[model samples]
Target: MRSALIAGTLLLAIIATIFFDEVRSLECYVCSRQEGNAEKCLTTTKTCESDENACQSEIRWGSTPYWSQGAEKQYYVTKKCAKKEDCEEYVNRFTSSCQRIWYEDWKCGECCQGDRCNYYIIMGAGNLKATWLLSLVTAVVIFRHIFAS
Candidate 1:
């Protein structure tokens, strides 16, 4: 009887974890060539197609030669649903990270899993690198501390 109780408890815990830990469908911010980091990009949300497993954000510059934000008209951002494999492929092929080149006209692509995981993506070179770097470092420290114990 005690053995049966232990088995049942273990099964219950496993099932509970499976059900509670991860989400089935991914959500992402949906914006297209929005000028600047518009407020709409931050607040807008959408459920991606079932096949899309990730969210992607890119910084685009149009017809600008200078290495600085030319104008609100020149700088734009597009954040949308993406497939994890595709986004990763581009990131691997073209650049090391979405950060760097915080100058101007830097084509940045980044993807993440989980619901609304791409919410932290910011435009512009300086702020984008700093924010993402800070977030990445903080997350690393937290995970290390949590797992090290």
Candidate 2:
């Protein structure tokens, strides 16, 4: 009975470590962006004039939704441009479908700012740390069971 208990504990510890390790390594792509300046207004083939001077924008990372306790949180990353070419390049990086703002068009919200991107990375790292700690605890438990038994 003692041996069985020890073996069970060891197995549980190993499973916990694997679970936490997998969670720690989970790559949840949040968002990233490159910033620049604008210089001129470029017209698309659709007759839409994307002002080059209007600031370049890039969605370094796309938006993702997080849900908790009946609340939903959205996250994304965006880069702003200071020159016309910069803004144009930022806009051009996406497909024509992503350029639209209204219905049927995708638009990035305020949460998609550069500062938020930093926050996302920080939070992601915290999650990773938590997972790592869980794995470490599991490893310690397993080691204790193996040698102390």
| C-alpha lDDT of all candidate models, in order | 0.64, 0.37
Q: How would you encode candidate 2's per-residue C-alpha lDDT over 1-149 as one tens digit per residue?
A: 67757767777766776665444322222223322111111111111133312222333222334334544223234323233455345445555535433323254321111111212221221313454556677777766866876
Displacement of residue 52 (Cα, Å) in model 1 is 0.7
C-alpha lDDT (0 to 100) for residue 96 of candidate 1: 45
Off by over 4 Å in 2: 1-4, 9-13, 16-76, 79-129
**Candidate 2 lDDT for residue 116:** 16
Report the C-alpha displacement of residue 117, candidate 1, in angstroms.
1.2
TM-score list, all predictions: 0.58, 0.27
Best by lDDT: 1
Report lDDT (Cα) of residue 37, candidate 2: 15
* Model 1, TM vs. native: 0.58
lDDT of 1 by residue, 34-110 (tens): 77667877889998887887788776655444446444326577788888799778757657444344443456677
